[model samples]
Target: MLSVVIPLYNEARTIVRVLEAVQEAPLPTGIGREVVVVDDGSADGSADVVAAYAASNPALGVRLLRHAHNQGKGAALHTGIAAASGDYIVVQDADLEYDPTDYAKLLQPVLKANADVVYGSRFIGGEPHRILFFWHSIGNKLLTFLSNAFNDLNLTDMETGAKLFRRELLQGLMLREKRFGFEPEVTAKMARIPGVRVYEVGVSYYGRTYAEGKKINWRDGLWALWCIVRYGLFS
Candidate 1:
């Protein structure tokens, strides 16, 4: 079974659609899917929407968890990861930026190629990508470069949210970061695991504009830089 951890906040508009897409996505034969949604204190009716969806679609195996107040994405992920009961875990955002159909592509390395972790990179393949946010793209590349410099891993999209990992391997790590910094911090820690085999695959990206509810900002990039240096060198 694969546990899909979706960390969301104030995504009332896209939450239900993304959940439906996840349920409809086709997985490898004999592989079952379980969705673990962590609502990070969304005030925009996101939690209620998820609850209603769960109640109506009981067969989808959707498990909804909530935080009393808004915590960071990492905190929500921490909660979801701890509650996950699958053999493998994959992080999925409630936003429409990532395509659910690509889950199988990211799982290929772990399922067949024996990868301990797989990253769905938005910068590698011939897959279609919505061209938006020039500065965001530059920042992501810079962060990925800095992270690679410290962790010594050749990842093209270190900030990507679409990551798949062996459940035990992930739950065993001592994670700390909470916000957008979760990306670099986890990557840094994952690289330190002895004999850990990490692979990357191309995935489609349908980025959202600021008016369309994109939440990450320049501050998160700075935090990620600090995380790369702190976790990479000290921890």
Candidate 2:
């Protein structure tokens, strides 16, 4: 089974749609999926929405966990990961930017090459991508480059939200980031694991604008750079 860990905040406007997509996404034969949604104290009734959805779809294996107050995304993920009982795990954002259909694509390396980790790259695919911020694109590439320089990795999308991991490998890590820094911190630590087989695949990106509820910004990019140095070089 694959556990989809969704670290949700105040995304009440899109959480239900994301849940439906997860429910309907087609997985490879014999691979069952369960959703672990960790609501990080959403003020917009996102937790209530998730509760209602899980109550309505009793057969979907949707498990809802809650934080009493707003912790960051990484903190929420820590909670979700601990509660996951699947053989493999994948992180899913509670937004429309990422399509759940690509879960199949992310699983290919695991089935064929015994990949311990898989990263879905948005920059290398022929799949449809909404043309958006040029600076953000550059920032992603620059961060990837810096991360590669520090960790000796060749990943094209270190900051990508779509990542898959063997449950044991993921739960073994000492992940400390509590916000947007999760991306760089995880990438660095995962790279340091001796003989770990990591893979990357092209995936579609339907990025959103700030008006469409996009939360990341340049400050987060700066923090990611610090994370790369801290985890990649220091720890």
Candidate 3:
């Protein structure tokens, strides 16, 4: 089964479309599906969207988790992971950047082959071109390069919000980073674990400008750098 963990905060503009895409997605034949949306204290009507979806599909097992305040993304995701009930868990964003239709592509390595963790790499071979921020791409590549040096695992996209894993892979991992540090923390620590196989596959990416609610700021780049060192050595 698949437990989709979505971190939401003031995403009312795109949550409904994203949720509907998942609802109509063609999941794997035998695996059941559950979508859990974590509301990171959105004053916007994001929770209402999840409620509406849940109201329509009782059998689909949709759940809404609300935070009293705007906790960081990592905290929201960690909460969702603890509550996830499927054998596999996937991190999905409320924005329409990543396509729900491509979920099967991301799940293939874990379900059919030899990977405990899989990331949808925007820079990989089969991915379609995406309009990107020049500095953002440069920053992402530099951080990923540093992560590769630290973890000794070559990865293309360090901060892609698309990550899938077997629930067992994350056993006992108390995630520390609350925000943008989440990705590097997971990748760094995950690379050190024994018998864990990680892979990256090409996936579609549709980036948005600031006016479109793209919230990652220039300062988050500093946090990513800290995560590469902090999780690699301290953790």
Cα lDDT, all candidates: 0.93, 0.93, 0.86
For residues 12-96, write the lDDT of model 2, one tens digit per residue: 9999999999989999999999999999999999999999999998999799999999879999999998998998999999987
Any runs in candidate 3 off by more than 4 Å, and if so which?
Answer: none
- lDDT by residue (44-126, candidate 3, tens digit) is 88898889878887886789999999988888998899899888888989998888777888888876786889999888867
Among all windows of ten consecutive residues in candidate 1, which has the lowest summed lDDT?
106-115
What RMSD value applies to candidate 3?
Answer: 1.2
Write down the lDDT that model 1 would get: 0.93
Off by over 4 Å in 2: none
lDDT of 1 by residue, 1-235 (tens): 9999999899999999999999889999989999999999999999999999999999887999999999999999999999999999999999989989998998899778799999999999989889998889999999999999999999999999899999999999988888988898889889999999999999999999989998899888888899999998986
TM-scores for all predictions: 0.98, 0.98, 0.96
Counted clashes in each candidate structure: 0, 0, 0
Q: Candidate 1, after superposition: displacement of residue 217 in Å?
A: 0.6
